[model samples]
Target chain A: MSSLDIRNLEIHVEGKPIVKDFTLNVPKGEVHALMGPNGSGKSTLAKALAGHEDYQIVAGEASLNGQNILKMEVDEIARAGLFMAFQYPSEIPGVSIANFIRAALTARLADNEELDAARYYRRLYEKMDLLKIDRKFTARSVNEGFSGGEKKRCEILQMAMLQPHFAIMDETDSGLDIDALKIVSHGVNTMRGPDLGILLITHYQRLLDYIVPDKVHVMWDGRIVRSGGKELALELEEKGYDWVKEEVAVV
Target chain B: MPATIEQETTNHSIDFDREVGNFKYKEDYSYDAGTGLNEDTVRYISGVKDEDEWILNFRLKALKVFESKPTPTHWASKDLESIDYSKIRYYLSKGQQPSRSWDEVPDDVKETFERLGIPEQERKFLAGVEAQFDSEAAYSNMKARLAEEGVIFVGSTEGLKEHPEIFRKFFGKVIPTGDNKFSALNSAVFSGGSFIYVPPGVHVKQPLQAYFRINAENFGQFERTLIIADEGAEVTYMEGCTAPKFETTTLHSAVVELVALKGARIQYITVQNWSENVFNLVTKRGMAMEDATIKWIDCNIGSRLTMKYPGVILKGRRARGEVLSIALANNGQHQDTGAKMIHAADDTTSNIIAKSISVGQGRSTYRGLVQIPKHLKNCKNNTECDALLINTNSRTDTYPAINVRGNRNSVQHEASVSKVSTEQIFYMQQRGLSEAQAMSLAVNGFVNDLIREFPMEYSVELKRLIDLQMEGSVG
Candidate 1:
C-alpha cells in the first residue's frame, strides 16, 4: 500500500510564513479534502508538498512511500510517484500537447525502453474521449491560448496519464462551469481506486459535491482546525468562512 | 576597333575601374606578385595566359585603375584596415590542368576534400561536383546522363576556354568588381568555381555542388561561379564550404553570377559552415528575365566574419525573386548577410525573410536593399527581418534600404530584435527540460518557420548544429 506523510510542515514565501505546523496523511485507497477560505494557506501547503521552487520548506518533513520528497528536485519529486496539479498552469508555446505528454511519459520509462507511438496514441485518444476533449487538441501547443476550462481539463488529463500514487489537485474547480466541473470530476472519479490516493484542495464545497471524498478538514491560518466526514464540506459551504473563523477562535 | 570590340573594350574599362586586374592568377602562375602590384606582374600574367594584345592592354589599364583607386573608409567595423594587400599571397595553383577524376588529383588536397564528406555527398546526391583546392579545380565529374541532356558542368577556367562567347557576354554584367572592396580582390585573382549551363527546355533535378577548401596558409580563395538556366527549365544548386582552422586568417572572396531565362526557375542554396578563422566575403547576384523566378536559401552557421549579399534583378515582366535566410553566430563570429532585389519590369515581385541568432558576444547584421523603378507600373515587395540575441553581450543590427520610386508599387518592411528572456528559460525548465535543452528549443522555435523551408536532411543537420552551439552556453 502506498502512503504519504507530512509532519510539522512549515512553508514560507518571500520571507512570510504561509503553511505552519501542517500535518496530514493519506494512504492508498482513500481521498482527502482540505477545505479552507482565501489566504488560508491550503494552496501553499499543496505547492510546498509538490516541491515548487518558490515555496521554501522551513522546519518540515514530507515523505512519499518512505522516500523523503523534500530532499528531491522538482522533476525527481514528480517522477517519485507524486503529482501536483497546479492552480495556474504555465502556458508553454510551440511545444505541442502531444510532445509534452510524450516527453513526460518518456522520462518515466527505462532508458532502454522506447515509447510505442501506435499504442500511445490509442491510449491518449481513449483518455481524451473520456474527458470529452477533441483529438485535434494533441496538435495544439501545451495550454497555449487555451480557455480556463480547457486548461483545467488538460491538467486532469495529465494526472490520468501519469497515474501517480498520490495527486494534489489545487482548486481544480476554479473558473469551471457546471458541465466542465462534472467532466473534470468524472475523469478524477474514474481514476480513483484502491491503488491511488488524492488530496483535493478547494476553496469551496462545489468540487467535493462531484468527486466525493472520504474525509474533509477545515483549515485556518495554515493549520487544520476541524475534521469530519464528507458532509463537513456541505456544512462549511452553508455556514461560510465566518463559521470556520468562529469555530477556530472558540477552540 | 569594331563596334562589338569597342563595346567590349568599354565594358572592360568600366570593369577595371570597379575591380583589380584579372591577371593576378596569370602573374602568380609565372612570376608571382613580386612584393607589390607592378607592370611586370601584369605582363607576366598576360604572357602566361597567351592573351591577345587587346586583353593584355586591358589588364595593364586595369592595373593602373586599381593602383589609382583608394581603399574604402566608411566601414562600420574598423578592422578592415588590417588587410595588407602586399602581405596577401594573391593566388596559388596545385596543378596546371583540371583533373576529371578524383584518383588523378593530388594526394594531400584530395584527402582534405574527402575528409569533409565531399566524396560521400557526391556519390549519394550530386549529379556533378567541381572540387577546388586553391585557384584551380583539382577534380571534376559529371554523370553521363546529364552530359547527354546537354547539361554543361565544368570549372570556370574551362568555361573561359571552351565557351568564351557565352562567358564573356555575361561575366561582369551582374556585379562588377568595383561593387565592393572584396569584389575588387576577387576579380583580380578569381580562379575556380562551378560553371553550369542547362540547355533549352532541359531540367536538371539534382544539385550541382562545389567544395572550396583552403589548405595553405597566407593564401586566398577567389572562386567565380556562373549558372544559367534556359527557358522552361528548373535547377537547384547547393554549395558547401569549409577550411581548416589556422592561426593566420585566410581570405575567401568569391563572385557568383546566375541568369534564369524566360520561363526558367533557379533555386540556389548555400550551407556555409566555414571554420571560425576565415574571412568569407562573397558577391552572388542573379538576373531573372521575363516570366522567370529565382530563389536564394542561405544558412550561415560558422565563420569568423562573413559578408554575403545575394541579389536578384527582375529584368523581365512578371519575374519573381525570394530569399529565406538564417544566420547563427556563435563565439567570435560575425555574420552580415541579407538580400537585394531590383524591380525593373512591370508586375514584378520580391520577398525577403532573414533570421539571426547571436550568442556569446557574437554579432549579426541584416543589410538589405529593395528598389522599384518609377517606370514599373505595378510592383510589390515584402521584407521581414528578425533577430534573436541569446545573451546580453551579443548584439544585432538591421539596415534595410527601401526605395520605391513609383506610386503604384507596394512595399512593406518590418523588423524586430529580441533577447531570449530568463522567464522563458525558467518556464521551460519547469517543464522538465534542461537549461541547454530549453535554450535550444527556444532558438529552434524562433527560426522554426524559416527552417521548414529546408529539406528534411538539412533541417535535421541544422538542428544538430544549433544544439551543439547551445551546449554549455548557459551561465
Candidate 2:
C-alpha cells in the first residue's frame, strides 16, 4: 500500500515493554494525530519506527510505501522516505544547519551524484524563510544554544527540506510558544499534500487547532485506545486524559 | 580574515591534497649518505653542502648532543624506541645543484609533480626548482614584485650561500641544537626547506607556499626552515608536507625556526599528510620581539606516529603568540601533538587552541606547556584543547602543564575529552546520513572552529581525510 503501515509493533527499552501491539496505518494524503498522556509510549513508538538502537523492535513490521523499514538502518529508513522530527533536536555544535541538511539530501542521491551547493543553500534559505528563521541561522551550528521555539521551528525546517513521504513529529509542539507554533504549523501545512503522510504525536489540543489533523488517535498503555475524526481531539482535550483512564477502568 | 568562507582562489589547487597520497616515481640518486647516523654521516652531509668551518663545527656539536641524549621515553609512547636510527637512509639526492630556475629542474621530477597533480606554481618550489613558473605569468609578476620590494624568498641552501648577512643572523638562534634529540639530529643533517626574509615595513599580501615534501622516496628527511620578518613587516607562509607512499621511507624530522622582529607579524601554516608507517617527529618554534606577533596553524594527518608541538617564546614586551592545530589519527596510528607558549616578557599574551579526533583503534594525546615565569607582569595565556573519540576502542588523552606563578599574570587552560555522542549520530542518521557520514560530521563539528583557521586548501584536505578515515572505520 502507498502508506506508512506499522502492524503489531512490539517495542522494548532495556528489556521492558514500552510499545505493545501498536498498529497504525497513515496512508498517503493523510495527517494522523497520535495523542497520548505522559509515559504512554508515544515517543518510544516514533523512535522505534525511526530505528533507534535503544528502542528495540522485538517483534513488528513497519513499512513505508511497501518498503520494509523495520529491516533498514536508521539512515536507510530515513532514505526510504521516513522522517522523524525529534522532540529534542540534538545540538551538534560544529555542523552548520546548511551542511547538515545538505548531507541528508546528498545521502538520498544515487552514487556519483553531487549536491549543488548553491542550489542547496538557496532551497535551505527558502525553508528558513518559511519557518521565520534568519538567513544567518544556516551558518550557525545546528540547534546550538537555540531556544525551545527555535528548536521546534528548526525541526520543521528540516522536515520541509527533506520532504519525506511520511514524517513522525514527536511532540514538535511541546516546547513552542504560540508564535513559533504558528510559524512551524504554517511550514508543515505548506508541506501537506497528496504525496505526504504525517503522524503528529502531541499531548495538547493547542496544536490541533492550528493544523487540524485528518484523523485523531488517543494512545493508552502502549496501544491505541480510541480512534476518531478531528473532533475527537477537542473532546479529549475538554474531558481530559483522566476521563479516558476511568472509562478504560470501567471497561 | 578567518579564511573560513574563502572561496577557492584556484580550481585545481586542492586536487593534490586528497588522501594518504599513493603516487610515486622511481628512485635514481647520485649522492647517497648511506643508511645510519654517525659522525661520518654528519661530515658527509656537511661536505655535500661544502659548508664553512663554523657550520661544520655546529653540526659536530649537534651530533654529540644527538648521541648523548637518550630517546624520549618519559612521556612518549614506546613506539619511539622502534625507529632503528641506523637503518634509516640519512640522505639521498640526484647530485644536481638545484638550478636557480624551474626550467633547469630535472625532467623526471617535473613529470612526477605533474603526475601527482601538483599545481604549476606549487610544483616549481616544491622540488626546490627555484619558484619559477614561467607559464604562470601572474605568479612570476608577484615574484618580481616581491623581489623589487627587497623581500628574500629562496631555498635554504641558496639563502645561506648568497644572503648570509640575513640568513645567518637568525639561523640556529631561535631553536638551538640542544632543544631536543630530534632537533639535534636535524641540526646535523638538514636539507630541503626554505628561507624567507621580509624587509622592514613591507606587507606581503598573498600567502607564500613552500614545500619540503618527502616527495621522492628517501630524498629528504631532516628538513630545516627559517623565516625572519624585520621591524614592522608581515608575512604568511604555508609548508606543504606530503610523501609518496612506499615501504622504504620511514622517518621525517624537521626543525623550523621563525623570528618576528620588533612590531612585525608572522603567520606560519603547515598541513602535513605523510604516507603510512612514517614517523613524523618535528620541532618548530618561533621567537617574537617587542610588539610582534607569531601565529602557527598546523594540521596533521596520515602518518603512523606524529609528535609535533609547535611552540613560541614571547621575548619582547607586549608580544603575542598563537597556535591553532588539529590532528586526526586513524587505525594503527598515534597522533601525539600539542603546543607550548613561554611568556618571558611583560604584558605578553598567547592563545592555544588544539582539537583532535581518534578513529578505530587510534589514539590522540594533547600535551601542552604554558609557562609564565615568576617575574613577568601582566602576561596572560589561554589554552583550549578538545578531543573527540569516534569508536569504542578509540582513545584520547590531554596532559596540559600550565605554570603561571608570577604576580599579575593570568592563565586559563580548558581541556575536554568526548566521544561522538550516539544520540547526536542517531539524530543525524535519522535525517539521512550513513553511520560513517554521521560520525564524520560530528567530528568536523567538533573541530570546526579550528579548521576555520586553516587555509581553505588545507581545510578541504583535512575534511576529506576525516571522511575517508570515518568510512573505513564505521563500515
Candidate 3:
C-alpha cells in the first residue's frame, strides 16, 4: 500500500508565502475531500504537490510511500505514482493524446524492455470506454480545442490509464456542467478501490454529492482547520464558505 | 594549421565585393580546363571520373548547352555575371573512402564529423547515415537489420561503381545536367551524396539521413544523390548541410533525383543551415509513377545566398506530389526556394506550401510553378505562400505561375505577407512566454501544419532551431 504525507509544508509563489504550515496525509484506501474558499491556498497546495516550478517549497516535506517526492523532477514525481489532475493543464501542440500517454508509459519502461503496443492500445481503449471517451480522442492533440467537459474527461481518462496509487484532483468539477459532472464522477467512482487514495480538492460540495467522500476537511487561510465525517461536506454546502471564514476568524 | 594543407585548400578567397571574382583553386583535385571555357575542361572532368566515352561526349555536348543557355535574368537579385566558373574548385577529395565503420575514418575528418553529431546519431536514431566532408563521403553506416532488408545506402560514387546498370539508367533522367548552370556544375564534379534504393515491398520505418559538411573555403562541394523506391516500397530520406563561417565565400551545388515506382511512396526532408558565407545552389527533382506519392520537406535557415527549388513530375495517373518549405533568412542572407509540379497524366494532385521568415536586411522569395497539360483531366493544384518580416529592412517576394490548360484542372494560389506587430509582442509578453519565445511560437505556429508531418523527434529539433534563431531577434 502507498500513502502521501505532506507535513508542515510551506509553499511560496514569487517569494511570497501562500501555503504556510500546511499538513495533510492520505493513507491507502482513503478518500479525503479538501473544501476551501477561493484564494485560500488550495491551488497553491496542489501546485506544490505536483512540483510546479512556480510553487517553491520553502520548508517542510512531501513524500510518497516514504520516498521524498520534493527531490524528484516533475516527470519523475509523476512516474513515481503521484498523479495531480491539473486545474488548467497545458496544451502541448502537435502532440496527440495517444502520443503523450505513450511517451509517459514508455518513460516508465526499463532500458531494455519495449512497450507492448498491442497491449497498450487494448488497455487505452478499455480505459477510454470506462470514462465514456470517444476512441477518436486518442488522435486529438492534448487539450487543444477541447471544451470544458472534454478537458475534464481527458483529465479523467489520463487518471484512469496511468492508474496512479494516489491522485490529487484540483477542482475537477469547475466549469463542468451537470452531464460533465456526472461523467467525471462516474470515471472517478470506477477507479475507487482499496489500492487507490484520492484527495479531491473542490470549492463546492456538488461534486462530493456524486462521488461521496470518506472524509471532509474545511481549509481556512493556509491550513485545514476543521475535519469531520461525510456530513461535513453537506453542512458546508448548506451554510456556505462564509460560515467557515467566520468560524475560523472566531478561532 | 599545416602549410601544405592550407595552401592546397585555398582557405581564403578574401573580399571580392558583391561580384563573383577570379580565384583559382589551388587544390590538386581540380582538373584544369585552361583559362577559358573549352572542350578540355569538360574532357578533363570526364577523364577524372573515368566516365564512359558516351558520358564524356555527353559532358562535352552539355558544355555547349551550358554556353548557350541564358542566365535566369527574370529572377530578382540573380546577378549571374558575378559567378566565375573558372575560379571555383570543381572537385576535391582527401582520399578517404566512405567507411562503414567510424574507426576506419581518418582522424581529422572524423573529428570534424564527430563535432557535428554524425556517428552518434547513427548509433542512436538513424538507421543509416552518410557523412560527407568537402567533396567525399568520410563515413557511412546502416544497421544490420536494414541491410538484411536489401535497402542499399551508400555514397553516390560507390553507387556508380557497384550498381552501374541502375546508376546509368536514372543518372540524369529527372533533372539533366543541362537543366541549370548549377546542375551542370554538379554534374561535372559531383562526388559523394547519398544513394538509396528501397527494395520492392520494403518499407523503411526509420529515416535514412546524410550530413554534408564543407570545411574548405573557395572550394565547391558538389554532391549527387539518387533515391529510388521500388514498386510498393515506402521510405523517408533526410539530409542536413552545414559549413563554417569564413570571410571568403564557399560554393555548394548538389543534384538530388528521386524516383517513386508504381504504387510507391517517398519522402525527402532537407534541413539546410549553411554558414552565412556559402552559396548553396541545389537542384532536386523526383518522378512519380502510377498511384505513387512523392513529398519534399525543405527547411532553409542560414546561407549567404541559397537558391533551391525541389520539384516533382507526376508522370502517371493518380500520382501525387507535395512540397512543404520553411525558409528563415537572417542578416546578409538571401533564401530563394519553392517548388514545381508537372502533371502529365489524368487525376494527378499536387500541393505546395512555402513559408519564409526574414529578419535584419534579409531577403526571401518564393518562386513556384505548376503546369497541367491540355489533355489531362481532373488535375488539382493548391499552392499557398506566406512570408513574415521581422524588421523594416527585411523583404520578401512571391511569384507563383500556374498554367492549367485543361478545363477540369483546379488550381488555387494564396499568399500573405505580414510583419510581427509590436502589439502582438506586447500581448504575448503579458502572458508567460518571453518575446523570443513568443516569436518562436508564432513562427512555429505559422508552419505548424507542415511541422505536424515530421516525426516527433524532428519536430522537437525544429522547434529548438526556431527558438535558437529567434534569440536577440526582438527589437
Docking class of 3: incorrect
Model 2, span B174-238: residue lDDT tens: 89999999999889888656778899999987778765455554433777789999999999887
Question: Which prediction has more favorable lDDT, 2 or 3?
Answer: 2
lDDT of each residue in B1-475, candidate 3, tens digit only? 1121232222122111111111222234333334334677557656656667876766666667767777676664564455666666555666535787899987777777666666766766678899887777888888889889989999987887778788788889999888987787677656789888999999998889998887766667889999999999999999877777777667888999999999999999987778777888889999999999999999998878889989999998999999999999888788999999989899899999999999878899999989998988999999999998888899999888888895888999999997776544432332223457556765765677788687654655566567677874666
Q: Which one is best on lDDT?
A: 2
RMSD of each: 9.9, 3.6, 11.4
Candidate 1 per-residue lDDT over residues B1-475, each given as its tens digit: 1122232233322121101100112122322443334667556545554555655565565555555666554754555555566666655675546788888876766666666667776876788888887677888898899999988888877887777777777776787757776666566656678788888888887788787766656667778899899897888888777666667777788989999999899988887777777778889899999999999988887778888889899999999999999999887888989999999899999999999999988999999999998878789999999999999899899989998996999999999887777656644444455567677877877787687687544565566667767884666
What ordering of candidates by TM-score runs from best to worst?
2, 1, 3
Interface RMSD after interface superposition, each candidate:
12.1, 1.8, 12.9
In model 1, where do residues sit more than 4 Å from their true spots? A1-12, A18-35, A39-86, A89-93, A99-127, A155-172, A188-201, A212-232, A247-251, B1-75, B79-93, B96-116, B131-139, B214-219, B244-248, B392-394
- Number of the predicted model whose DockQ against the real structure is largest: 2
Task: Kindly give the stretch of ten consecutive residues in candidate 1 chain B with the minimal lDDT sum.
Answer: B14-23
Please compute DockQ, using alpha carbons, for every candidate against the native two-chain complex: 0.16, 0.69, 0.03
Off by over 4 Å in 2: A242-251, B1-17, B99-104, B120-142, B215-220, B245-249
